[model samples]
Target: MRPDELDTALNNLAAEHRLRQRAILHSPQGPHVRIDGRDYLAFASNDYLGLANHPALKTAMQQAIDDWGVGSGASALVAGHFAIQQQAETALAAFTGCEAALLFGSGYAANLGVISSLLGRGDAVFADKLNHASLNDGCLLSRATFRRFRHNDVAHLEQLLRDTPAKTRLIAVDAVYSMDGDEAPLAALLQLAERYDAWLYLDDAHGFGVLGEGRGVLFDHALHHPRVIYMATLGKAAGVAGAFVAASHSVVNWLINSARTYIFTTAHPPAQAAAVLASLQLIKDEGWRRLQLQRHISRRHLQSGVGGCQPAFGLAVLAWRVCR
Candidate 1:
């Protein structure tokens, strides 16, 4: 694009009130935060379980920094893998009931790496219309026949699956959509995937620490299948950094070898993994946090009767309010 076109685009966005800016953060992530020289109750964060500022995590991170230094010093395949990261991966795999798990620098990279590695020119990707931008970008990057079905519409997805002639197919979606506070029909989607011989990819960033007794969407629904690939970010409820993909041992192995993002980027700080370990323990022991979250949500959605959400996919999709 030329400079004149870029200027016009910026002017148009400003005129339409669509441009956004970053706010300066002055305090740790929590319900109450300091931003832009003001203290306010914050609901914009993904720290659903509220462990981002926990003392235990701070201590763990500090100790890790002292012991292991700040950086991993290289990529995971190039002597950057550490014992703590391995431990976190093992714990995460067991927690999610997957055969294996692989960590990525962030949720965006994880999605991009997993999707692009699994599908290429000959594969087809059926995604929800409201899927996160990273998922859509990954599909485009994979050079696949990307088909977007209506959000939560199983029939639309099924129709697309029936029409697609690609050999390898993938169905990708968010387990719990943050904007709507509604969950995907994992069981129904799994059925469709099995029927079409397509793999299902679930991004559970918002569901991990808040749903399924802090285990995630799979346990909440009691749904599991060999054709499912699950990914979640620790920065949300896990209260740290990095994302993990949990799937069959074979899939994990393939990602390790083929995912360009994972192979090229420097490993995330090992200290973050230590913080994640600390966060995991808190999530496991603290049942009241989940109850508190439920209570907070109920007051706004169930009691107030304001901003209620509608059902989708022939099932009740719960509404979620952004702020308290």
Candidate 2:
């Protein structure tokens, strides 16, 4: 607990990270950016649509500021909720094909709000081995019995389901595994959810605005019902900041009433919402962006210069092409 000890520990962690990999940033988030004063063709960001720099989104934010001002002022339960926020939620629900949507300050908070709010002591939460840290942490916070199934293994998940007591169960997964670019087995996962009589929570942080006619993985799979609740981040492929949960109106009502993160934290600014709204439009209207992204990923992996990615994880491995 001494200051010297703390400093040494922090330095050790930094050294470890450097030993593994180091990140240096010197410019804005984009395809090409300066890293440590040197420009690099960047592929490290999640701005899949390249809409983060769109002038239309910026213009929309400016107009939103003119109408709704700057800060949210307080939490949604207080005076922070605005017409713009409601409008954004409506748009999100419509885009995702859900009953209702609730916006949050960020994706982390949104996941925490939804997961902890729904599952508590005695409830069993089944998570995929490689779900986001937020999902794992939310399960811990819920004081529920947590079980992690092998990543994308429906058979293993079914076995776990069979052993689980006939109680209310919550199944959590990421629609697109972040570190690994591979997607979830959506149809199979949904079938498992039905057989197990459990609620399926899909966090589409990286897939939103990039998949399913730009709707997301759930829509891409053509599966819909009351059993599914979707969570996504706007800061990723959506090319904006903030997060949301789209589900049945009753679920949204429950979160608004009971979710502490939503109740305690200040809502996102109206300007950000406006920017997201603009980005959403671009994502839906443009199909070429998605195709290009897919093609780029595939080609990069196939080229001997870049080297082949491990087929299982879909994880991107960037390497300098070595010339013979």
Top candidate, metric TM-score:
1
Q: How well is each residue in 1-324 modelled by candidate 1, as lDDT tens digits?
A: 787799898888999999887899999986577899999767566676678888999999999999999989999999999999999889888888888999999989999999999999989999999898989999999999999999999999999999999999999999987666678889999999989999999999888877888989878887667899999999877878889999889999999999999999899999988998899899999988778667666655655465646222111111121332
**Runs in model 2 lying further than 4 Å from the true structure:** 1-4, 18-26, 304-324
Count of backbone collisions in candidate 2: 0
lDDT (Cα atoms) of all candidates against the true structure: 0.85, 0.82
RMSD of each: 3.5, 3.8
Question: How many angstroms is residue 240 displaced in model 1 relative to the true structure, after the best TM-score fit?
Answer: 1.2
Residue runs of model 1 more than 4 Å from their true location after superposition: 303-324
Evaluate residue 126 in candidate 1 and report its C-alpha lDDT on the 0 to 100 scale.
Answer: 93
Tens-digit per-residue lDDT, 1-324, candidate 2: 887797787788788884345678877666577887788776456666677777889899999999999998888899899987888899999999999999998888888888899888888889999999999988899888899999989998999988988488888999888775678888888888898898999999887887788899768998677889999999877878989999999999999999999999887797898897888888888887777666555555676344433221222212211110
